[model samples]
Target: MFYRHDNWRVGLNFKNLFDKKYYESQGDWIRSGAPFTVLGTVSVEF
Candidate 1:
């Protein structure tokens, strides 16, 4: 979701909305993935 007004802007982002469990493998390494993450941002221009 996002919103904008004049010179100001706002936004939201979701990486993992379901809160699921997962993993990742790279070469000889194993890593766990992020769960149920939410990111938000805002900006203004002069």
Candidate 2:
């Protein structure tokens, strides 16, 4: 979800809500998994 104003904005987000196992492969290395994550942000533009 997101919101915007004349000079300000706010937003919220969630990643891996279910805490599912997510894997990332880099070269020959593999990441196990990532847990659920939540994020929020605020911004202002002049």
Candidate 3:
């Protein structure tokens, strides 16, 4: 979700909303993905 107003801005983001478990494999290497995460931001013009 995101919002903006008169030279100002706000935003929110989500990576894994369900918090599920998963893995990745490349060649002979194995890795795991991230869990539930959230991000927010705010900005303004000069």
> Which candidate number maximizes lDDT?
1
Error of 3 at 21 (Å): 0.8
* Residue-level error in angstroms, candidate 1, position 34: 0.5
* Stretches of model 2 off by over 4 angstroms after superposition: none
Candidate 1 residues lying further than 4 Å off, grouped into runs, are 26-28
Q: Is candidate 1 or candidate 2 better by lDDT?
A: 1
Worst 10 residues of 2 by lDDT: 30-39
Model 3: lDDT of residue 12: 96
Give the Cα error of residue 16 in candidate 1, in Å: 0.7
**lDDT string, candidate 3, 1-46, tens digits:** 8899999999999987999999879999989988989999999998
The runs of at least 3 residues in candidate 3 whose Cα sits more than 4 Å from the true structure, single-residue gaps closed, are 25-29
Residues 1-46 of candidate 1 have per-residue lDDT tens digits of 9999999999999987998899989999999999888899999989
The lDDT values for all models are 0.93, 0.89, 0.92
What TM-score do all the candidates reach, one by one?
0.72, 0.80, 0.74
Score candidate 1 by lDDT. Answer: 0.93
- Clash list (residue pairs), candidate 3: none
What lDDT score goes with residue 9 in model 1?
95
lDDT string for model 2 (1-46, tens) is: 9999899999999888888887989999999776888899999998
